[model samples]
Target: MKMKKKSATLLTTGMALTLALAGCGNGSNNNNAASSAPASGSASAPASSQAASTGNGGSAVEITFWNMFGGGEGDFVDQIIKGFNDSQKEVVVKQLRLESNEYYAKLGTALSSGKGPDVAVAHVDRISPFVKAKQIVPVDDLASKVGLDLSQITASNLQSVTYDGKPYAVPLDTHFHMFYYNKDLLKKADLLNEDGTPKLGEMTPEGFEKTLAQIQSKVPDIQALAVNTPYFQEPFLNLYYEAGGDILNADMTKAAINNDKALSVLKFYMDVYKNKYADLNDKNPWDSFSNGKAAFWFGGVWEAGVLLGDASKNIGAMPLPPIFGSQTHWASSHLLVVPSYVSAEKQEASAKFMKYFSEVGGSTWGKAGHVPANANVTASDEYKSLPYRDQFIEAQKTVKFAPQTDKYTTIVTTIAESLQNIIFGSESPEDGLKDMEKQINEVLDN
Candidate 1:
């Protein structure tokens, strides 16, 4: 029953967010490396010939890595792995690119069967169940041996991966929700300040509404906000957090979402779609923003690399505005963990790879638009100078992660459906909130 619960919760998040990308490196075979299954020896490693000739006189320990990263993020992971492979002679990390939905379930199953990858990627919030299931091993000793600087990592990020005072995973990056604006569109709408930043008069609900209205009135052809279905639930949650709402009560015994603040936030979200400031049915909201048809986009810092790399676009980024008198932001972190079933040698090798990618290769990952969990890296001149990163770096302080519970995926899934229903006009915010509260409470009670 516990395993079943783990599989259900983990798989839901994996599948919903997995991305596949082109231009992956590190000798990863495009044909064999991509799989929706867990990384067993027979399933997701490279052939012997793919080993790094430069590493350990061609006798490197090749370890399997299972992760859900694709597109630009995928490319960055592959590059980091390739760099580690090239720089070392002791470890050759072979990556298995798994689709998100298939990843967690397969990983849980394989770990139970003692056939999981040597190293795996787990989101900070999602790591708890794996820890409880005893499927992932703590990396403290291995991390120490590899000279991992835990002290240099951000306090909140380090805390996220720590379970029972033991470090179960190495945090790679902090991906938080932030605001992305089209420079030209905001300027045309007269929403720009003297410094060229969006001059949304205040952070109040009315202020935000007026700003959206101004942009919509001036642009006419573009959306004031660009967002897809998968991302629709975030702003609601962020606003709820800003309004001083908590997902769970003090004891984590039940859902605490059916409140006035939540209702107010939900109503505001629905109005965005109703007023035509955004399209509820828009298939590719990022496309609208990317093509200069949207003035404001609320998305992860991961969008930084793509927008900055595009020479045709002028993008400005900022933390999500304080719409409810607080600047709370939604956030999550990518953590590198070692599965418990691996041998000591493999564990050490995996730890070395994790350290390299997260510490030595931290700068490169930062360039991809995520805030590195490594505090020293973030403070470095290189990271500080990256395209719009400095503008939103301050948001790390107020970033609010989802509640840490085994039922997180279930709760998030419930809220997402309810949000979509409200946006689609199939359910009213009041009804949606009631349903969300009931469903979430049921999950918690179970």
Candidate 2:
């Protein structure tokens, strides 16, 4: 994923264009920059009038959908879309895939030009910018029309995509970092509890180190703690939030993470690699844990899809250890939203699809290692019975996200780079904090 250095400026221009065009609301065709065809879909359908359905008992309204998923997650989304097509006769959704790095840019351009897909998947964090710019309309009306019950969705996920008490998107799932342990390795270390969970005595830095040392002493050839470097930012942010600090000020105009609390959090993370409890150079944490070479793995819940398939390894998940005195975890979500300027039939069709995904497809989506955003789905016996989900599903109530600003892409990129520098020992924790604060404040100022 190539990230723009001047993403703050680029995002601002895209959003401004959206606000300007949203006022038009005339549903006129215009230039679309996202039709590069980097990926395939149902068909080469134009963003024109509603397509007449020729399938079952009635005319099915055809609607286009765009999404930014790949690998297993992509397959899961495709399966759900296929299920919808198979179970419905009133709507036909044409799904299009796009490169994630450039998704927002293309989406903003298309919506501003009145030529975007009728429905699209947006990150809960990224939807704020589109909502603020009015590129996506409020979906409360649609929710009401479809008899969608807001109480079924998690409050955090529902609030994440809402602005000024108005809903902008329908949440699909909540993805967060969780603690996974190899049950066999834990049993060998005598750290496996009777409940099939790891036996860490206490949730403190000293206690955590002691538990890791015990595991290391038993499995001398394996890493006691394994974490994927690419997703290090998630745990890092979780630590920051746990330390009673925040990523930005209330006004979202300045960085709020340059204080002692934040520094202490960074030092806590640095000590993990400094004391030799974990290897910072391990490139594949998931493989390390799944292959029984690692005792503990901290990563996104999405790994369940792959890890659950390893019959030789027994895996157990738990909420991240509350060593920092806070139960909060870093999280994000996939949300369904309608773009501005679309036909009434398209709106109805899109709303119906959203309802189906949240109501009918929630359980299937959970199999992809995501906690369903719908509360009923999460509480269902089928969802709770899934391996390792019961251990971490409670995290939805305390999950935290970065501030909602139009410059979100820039802020996260800057913070991720700073964390990587610290993890790779290219920069000291102090230097990393200074760099993060400077870069984040600069983006906020812009």
Candidate 3:
């Protein structure tokens, strides 16, 4: 669960929205690192033996890296930095870990001022405006300079960061939702399969509800499904995407969320809340699921450490069922990018660091619960050894990334707020959908 604090006022376009989106950190900082660490003695060798020495008497090139990773993710990043620093001693990488809430604002200001980190982490969805504003530079040539083969990356992951036929960033991983179920609770409800999986019957909204109703009837005290009402956008996007809904039309010129597919998904969730299939008021729904008070959860791959770590928890994970039609679901990627303001030498150094992060550090990163974007890493036996990685990979295959629009941050924030109002009864679903469409159009027009 990537916890983002939305602003009260929407940032419509230009540099403001881009900066806000850039700072938006993905995933929760509450995850425990202990559960996500790689097995002992499994670290791979250095990604490159080539030196990143400055022309000045073989001095190491020093570069600053910026990111919003915290808790377990932050720990993994720290390890990667150490590994890169120790690998060849040609480049020294220093990191500045910022609080996610304030990250984009500062990054925006720094980029505008041409004085910030040489290397930084940006979400794929958030970099469009930066590209427009020329705050970040393309990485294809730089990657080649450092012997980093961009072709080794997953094609979709590579494509997400490409604009105008040039790659801007090195994608780290694809993060998305997984259906997690409590085996004990499912067994009590007679919904557990003989294979230790949930016997999810009939993959329709109504059929899924029937399964929930059974759990409610048999195991009366627990929440049958733990809906993420707090971060409602995630669960909303997951199912809406499955239903073949798009946030914008093909041209990316207008709002496209006010259709039957969107409405159906909204109503389905409303019904879930109304029927007590899930507790709408459970403020800490993630905690509820982790504490065994909920039978099912549409949790993130980033949660693998917490949800799948304990053998006693009896948790099982799989790709989200294709209830609405297809397995397509919402996903985002973490990308390593170089600011346009960075020197050519630093950009090359950044490229080296990015290559190592993708090639050598990828396995360690996968332990932090994201599906590594490196094709080689995913094919490696080490990545396959992780729990539920195959499911993560499968889910990653059909993910629908955010539309390539500069106004996406504003549009999505509006959707999040509007969906909340609709679900909480302040506005009817029909009215809310109309208002949301109008609001998005206004932003797009601006």
Scored by lDDT, the top model is 3
TM-score of 2: 0.87
Clashing pairs in 3: 2-27, 23-104
Which stretches of candidate 1 lie above 4 Å from their native place?
Answer: 1-59
lDDT of 2 by residue, 117-223 (tens): 88999888887777777889898999889888877898888888878999889999999878888899889899998988889888877788889889878878888
lDDT of 1 by residue, 227-268 (tens): 665567787787888898988887778889888999888778
Write model 3 residue lDDT over 1-446, tens digit each, in one string.
12322332343344676766565532222221221111110111012112334333467777778899999999999999999888976688867777787777667777777776788998989999999898999988998899999999999999898899999899999999999999999999999989998998999999999999999999999999999999999999999999999999899988999999999999999999999989999999999999999999999999999999888998999999988989999999999989998888888888999999999999999999999999999999999998888888888899888998889999999999999999999999999999999999999999
Please rank every candidate by TM-score, starting with the best.
3, 1, 2
Candidate 2 local distance difference test against the native: 0.81
Put the candidates in lDDT order, highest first: 3, 1, 2
Residue 243 of model 3, lDDT score: 98
TM-score of each: 0.87, 0.87, 0.87
Q: What's the lDDT for candidate 3?
A: 0.87
Model 2, 57: alpha-carbon shift in Å? 7.5
Per-residue error (Å), model 1, residue 411: 1.2
Error of 1 at 199 (Å): 0.8
Provide the clash count, candidate 3. 2
lDDT of 2 at 212: 88
Collision pairs in model 1: 14-100, 14-101, 15-100, 15-101, 21-71, 56-89
